[model samples]
Target: MRGTALGAGVLFAGGLGGGWALYTKLSDNITADDAAAAELARYERERPTALVRGAQNILVIGSDTRAGDGNRRYGKDSGTERSDTTILLHLAADRRSATAVSLPRDLMVHVPGCLQSDGHRGEPSFTLFNSAFEVGGSACTVRTVEKLTDIRVDHYVVVDFSGFKDMIDAIDGVQVCLKKPIDDKAAKLRLPAGRVTLDGEQALGYVRARKSLGDGSDTGRMDRQQRFLGALVSKVQSSDVLLNPAKLYPLLDAATSALTTDPELASLRGLYQLVRGVRAIPTEHVQFLTVPREPYVYDSNRDQLVAGRADALFSLLRADRPVTVTKKNTSPGDSASPAFHGNTAAEDSCT
Candidate 1:
């Protein structure tokens, strides 16, 4: 319900940008519309898999790049940017349900060799999962994920800091809950414990603030980000944002402006079709969960996917089956594996 436009661009913009596909056609030369259409056509040619019974796997990468306006304030672009956030979004074949699996950046994984943006290719190696993004942008990241999960990714969308901030401001603000006071200088966030509505800048800081938030852990920060996203979805779907062209236009422009996508997903037509399918699912059917993982045995700072559990989760997605997330503790002394967990689109923001 809340993400139809911006939940990695597949969730919230379901009804708003449907008109984009009518504007252009694919051609050999790369014009604004031409470039996008050609890109999508190229992807169609190179991808190894066909559509799976109507199911779609979209990789949404939230890049923490300081290359654009309002973003450079964060820091200078030191050449390449790491994926600040990554979600493997799975839309069910029937368009009746959607599941977004968050992949932790700190996880240790095999980064396959890939062609870089600069026309050079890098070799595969064992490194942080986010390193794939740094080495070859989204393609490399997608390759690594496919190799790791054995599930084909149909499309991808990369959004930078400025875009995320602009979208929030376009929508007014998003509501969030804070259990205690927080003042993180590094993230530029300062807030008191309570329910509050956050504007663009504050929302970014809220999601990015780690040192001053719960347990000072990435997992805790991710939970907050998930809840904030849930609230944003609620705001968009419940309001007349999609129906009101005046309000929808800015939101659409902000979202589209911030995205770098796969060829097929690069055009308005491709995205319109995607949104149409996603809109068929009710918010209650959409679910969110993190990939099951634990600290690497050799290094507590880095993470390694829990072999059996991780494979089971990936397999369910590969088969387009419903993922069962129980609220029961299956491990001892592991806060990461909570006894009660997981969130769906229908969750109350206050909870």
Candidate 2:
């Protein structure tokens, strides 16, 4: 199945990054308030659990800050860059069929009015949605997404480059099949081809190096990232870590040290339960894709996501139904040519 091995890698990565044992890590780091973390965790536990729907949307952000020792090498004396990486995973309620959609950080979006630990404070603005994180934080980003897509984000997860490495290392190493050699000066990675295992450090470079890969577009990087993630998923499912206590401990410790999640997935137990659905899902049903896109309406240099296509895909997930992306040939009026015809969704795995 697609990503079956990668899923296993992701599971180990999750633990290496940290588990519920360290759910309090993020809560402890927040300067917000004493009662805030508990309140958030409580709300997450008590949040209205939903029935398995065909699809669901999750916003995954990869922060660029190299604030800690583990991350400094990636940043290398440079200031933190924008999240450059944004992915939206649409999972069928059944947890069988899935699709990963990537959003370019440069997409011009309508940032909406938001709320945070405090009460309402400002009006909406017109800028990229990712900039919302820099301006305010999660609340603003959530509100902006709500405003732009009218999609109520059920959950949110934010991980930095350091976390990605820790997660990779926790899984021991993920095996990847490379067709050719790669040398990226930016990420400081020069690797040969073959199915070699990747540690967190090497994995980080593998995902972040774009200049030496494909068309040198962020879109190309995203494609490779998806393949890596897919492999990570497969690894997690087929591996014995979840069933092996000895291997699980170090993985959990690493993951806990590197992560900071929203209140919903703030605790180790909470995050585990949510991902448990994916862990149990079948490999063939999972797929990854970038949102349908074209050159920006204004700037030829940037890419703009297709409006109705993404929104429609999200709708299918929200409904827990099946959707098949078809390809259009080079014939007349063949503007869209979807690369993959992802399979239809099936039974809810969570159930």
Question: For this target, which candidate reaches the highest TM-score against the unseen true structure?
Answer: 1
Each candidate: RMSD to true structure?
Answer: 5.3, 7.2
- What digit string (tens of lDDT, one per residue) describes model 2 on residues 1-351? 222332333354457545443445533432222233443343343232344543466667677776766777665645434565777666677676676666666677776554333545456676665777665455455455545555555666667787678777777877777777777677776778777788888888888777777788777787668777767766666546555645554555555555555665655555555665665666656766666667888887666667666666555555565655432232212225223322212211122
lDDT of 2: 0.59
Model 1 ranges off by over 4 Å: 1-51, 326-340
Error of 2 at 54 (Å): 8.6
Q: Please, what are the lDDT tens digits per residue for candidate 1 over residues 63-169?
A: 98888788888888797799998989998898888888888889999987776667776887999999988887777788778778888887778888988888888
Off by over 4 Å in 2: 1-56, 76-81, 113-123, 325-351
In model 1, the worst 10-residue window by lDDT is 22-31
In Å, residue 298's CA in model 2 sits off its true spot by: 1.5
Cα deviation of 155, candidate 2, in Å: 1.3
> Pairing residues by index, what is the TM-score of model 2?
0.75
lDDT of 1 at 275: 67
